[model samples]
Target chain A: MNLKKPLTAETISLDLKGDSKDAILAEMVDLLVASGHIRDREAVLKAVLEREKRMSTGMQNGIAIPHGKTDSVDCLVAALGIKRGGVDFGALDGQPSNIFVMTVSPDSRTGPHIQFLAEISRPLNDAAVRAKLLAATSPDEVLHLLIG
Target chain B: MSGPAELHPLVQFVFQLGVLIVLTRVGGYWLRRWFRLPGVLGELIVGMLIGPYALGRFAWPGLGHLFGLAPGGGAVTPELHAVATFASIVLLFLSGLETDLSAFLRYSVVGTVVGIGGVVFSFYLGAGCAIWFGLASGWLDPTALFLGAIATATSVGISARILSERRKMASPEGVTILAAAVFDDVLGIIVLAIVVGMVRAAGDGQGIAWADILLIAGKAFGFWIGATAIGLLLARRFSRILKYFQSPEAIAALALGCALLLAGLSEMVGLAMIIGAYIMGLSLSRTDLVQVIQKEVEGLHNVLVPVFFATMGMMVDFGAVQAVLKVGVVYSLLAVASKVLGCGLPALFCGFNRHGAVRVGVGMLPRGEVALIVAGIGLTSGAIGQDVFGIAILMTLVTTLLGPMLLAGSFENPASGLRKPEDAAKTESKEIVLSFPSPDMADFMRARIVRAFRQEEFYVYRLAPDTPTYHIRKDEMFFTLECEGDTVVLRVTAQYEALARLVVVEEMLALRSMLHMAQENVNIETMEHELVAGLFSDDGEDGP
Candidate 1:
């Protein structure tokens, strides 16, 4: 509901390393837990993993958004990251994904789930926004690009 | 508790369906991206997760009770089924409608043989594996074997999608996989009949006999024959009637009505509704209706297929699968290996080199959702204990699970730009002739052909004059291709004009044509159906 929420450098800098999708999700989970936004990081990670074990959410446009909701996360949280070289998210289009918007919400509300999907999907609908995200110098630039 | 007028049915359906769709899309996208699994599998898995079996969501209060869930909580809803069923019909029909029928026509012989071999070999192997596992553990039953047979089906839609992506679909190897798959489908259907008959026999006192098997086959075949003959004749008439419906709404309503009616009739006859839908699609395939129907059907399926696939997830309890986890893993691996070894080895024997064999094997690996349908049949029949079908589902899980990687791997360094002219000619050649059992297709040969050859028109044959008196040169080689209703007969004379004159004509060779198919099938004029060919003079020209 709050589209104008301020994102700190710490909030924006997500863990993204390696072609392995799990490593990225793991880093993001650890970051969220360390930030104290989420309890039981393992539960959140398991939820994400199990959800993925259901299907791959790689949008197949050099974008992969791995997401999950669990009781372990209180308010809705999103970890936005960019992998310039792209990670193999196992997309149907056979293209590697570079942008990952990992979102976690409470176990119940489907609202946050759809909202997060929109936040990521809507930006992706814009070529310039995508270009900005890809061209940004740092995670701070990435956040500015996102908010801008 | 309110009156029907208080809550509009449309609003209710939308509300319920909205949840399923959003959940499915979000869940499917996330799971698929995270797990590196197929979208369909993800949809189904999430359906299970959010269904009553896991956490709870909106329930079809009626079916929730049927599923032993406490009232008013679950993922199962009637509104979803309506769309899901619609999608299933379109999905299967589109599969039938979209099939590269020409590939099957050209490579019918080798593909049929290889496909049959794959199906029979895999069925028995899976059965053997089932029996062995059962024996080692405790005991084996017919159910496990049945489950194995079901596992043997190639799930053509999945394989086709994968093959199309790799650009290997039209290659001899690709064509062979598809052909064999269609052949396997036929065999699978027959095998399904036998198994179902056996089950029926087990239930009642109906004895299993060659007579009865033949009778059942005959009935199924007869039903199809009768239906096809009626359908095609009607399809033509429908084409006539289709002219009356110029508006999109009119055509859509008509198509939906026809589809639903055919789907219903198919069930009354014990055939898979998809089979009927396929035949319906094939019938319409002959008319301009295919394009219109395809567009309409896909439009509908955009709303339908995700739900069907998602509902499948709701039905599968992957969390509770720990009991069958070990067997699932083992069978899944075997399923992958058997297709590789069983299908791959024979392709090698058929003069395809190792890469060709590997291509064939990899092409056959993705089983798609029909495998789950087979697993369902097994579980419901009590032929396979829940545990055994559970294992069968495991195999589907793996095969469907690995589609993306297998596809990516197959395309890694494709064969160096197809076979050479001479080598490619050997694999499968196309020809079209004017005369019945025409000799010396030389008259149809043209010397000094035009430049700018289209790749589809790669083999240009110029129709030149050649006969006893004309006596076109014997040494010249040519290739010919033809189509019914459509014609691309180019006769290009050899580099040597004198050599080009002679055309050794072979007698018309009818393929392993099934008499039943020919009898009931109507002759429709489709340019696409024309036979395309190339003629080579045996001395220079080869003729039988």
Candidate 2:
């Protein structure tokens, strides 16, 4: 139920350089790889992209939750990215998505991934919180805004 | 007679079969559309017309007696008759597969007693007629036993059609009639098995005693019950094995193969082959493969079932029928009365009133296909003569024609058939309706809900091809989801209401998340293009 356990400052990307949906997803996965949370980068990326093919994870209000299940991660790992100018991620409302919360969990497990998604979705649902998180300059600041 | 030096029997059979199929199809269709009667009646009439006693007796210059009897005085060529017999096996096999085990259990208490009553009454009455008219020596006579066995079958299809047409399918009487009909079929088959065993025993030159009769009945009943029990237990495993074939047609063909194997085994064990075929079907009835197998084998069913009926018709000796006209009439009347009194009387004690009883009784009157099949077997085995077979057909035609009329009339009163009327209210299921803004939205929601349930590991399948209805089942839980235009309806029992609501809530949450994603991903370029196009249109020039 705690978002702080999975969404760490090390895994937060304040200024995402990726200009496209696939690029942004790769940028986010790179953060998780950098933090040493994922064992196999390709496996995690393949899972996330495969999940995206089923349905666009780009939600409303400048938020998107791209998630996948893969055994490359022993537990649930997440990375948060902010594309301030926004990128087209096939959001439901036909608007660009600025914030992305990507989670990769072990395929054998289920509960922690759904719990993290639900927790992250709650704070992102608030317009004011999304705006503050989008404006945050530092990774630590982004983490505090999301977790707190 | 000299033409073509007497064409080969195989060639003659091929010609006869081609003619039979063409005439029967045309005749069946005409009867169904013109008279609103069952197609089987038309098939029978057509068969009789083209049979040896009529048009078949005449010889053509080249094809002498194209539809005539076989050289040894059989009604039809042995090749054609073999196909007809195969058709009967397929018919019973499909019947067994289509049996509604849940419904059968649901109405077991009332249905069991009513079924038993109908069988007991009809058997005795029919056999008594045979004996009184000098067709048999006593109750133990093979002809008497065959007559009784034939009488016990009540064609559920005939009654079900009538009840469905009247929109009384959910009525107490309707449910009871259907449930009892299921039992009637099972019991009728059992009776046939017992009779076949006895007849075979008698044929072996054994002096029939009371003990021997009991032993034969036990062996027949035991084989059916044992096979069905074991088959049900192994059905799921058997289905899994069949899945290895990976093709629907292969699975269906293999299933029919198993049916045939079991049928032959049944004969080895001294019971009727149809019983084994029925057992094989009943075993697989509870598995997920029922619909798949049914859809795959439907082509085979349509091509063969009519031939079986028509062949039975061809075997009807009109000369023998006329010789026993008095007995046939009396027997037909007794057949109708026995079903009404036997089946109806039991319904009154269950929950139905006199009117309801009459409906149930009338519904059970039609002996239809099963009776004909039994009589055909009797004649083929020489347990009964042509005259008896002719009388059996007479009874089938009479009851089949009369059943629908009497069933329709019984419902004319527009009164509740239940004794208290409140009992009808008690069995009504709780329905939850979810209304959408449009039919498209409803369809989308219905599909998503079904997908969610599938993800939850519920076995989901469409109930019928033409309807937007689905049946969901997992473990002990069951629900029927139906989509009607802009509304989706879920019907469940009271105990499952909480579970149903939980599934709905989870689906709604998933939908909300999807909606959120759609809103967030909206493209700014497309919206701007639409706006620009609208603002700079030729019509906008006049407005400006």
The DockQ-based CAPRI class assigned to model 2 is incorrect
Clashes of each: 61, 17
Using all chains and alpha carbons, the TM-scores for the candidates as numbered come to 0.53, 0.67
Task: Report the TM-score of chain B alone for all candidates.
Answer: 0.65, 0.82
lDDT for each residue of candidate 1 in B73-130, tens digit (9 for 90 to 100): 2234455555666667776676555443334445446566677667766776676676
Model 2 per-residue lDDT tens digits across residues B1-544: 1222266888888877887888888999998789877778888888888887667777756887777777778887788889998888898998888776655665448878999999999999999999999998888889999999999999867676676566564456765676788788888989999999999998865547777898999999999889999999899999999999999999999999999999999989988888898889889988879888988877888888888888899999898889999999999999999999999999899888898899999999998878988899899998999899999999999998999989999999977677885664543345778998899988988998787666554556564343576666543345667788999987664445545664665566667778777778767656656667656566675232
- The list of candidate 1 runs beyond 4 A from truth reads A1-148, B1-16, B30-37, B57-83, B100-103, B106-108, B135-146, B156-167, B185-211, B318-320, B377-385, B410-544
**Candidate-wise lDDT, in order:** 0.57, 0.82
Interface RMSD of each: 27.9, 8.2
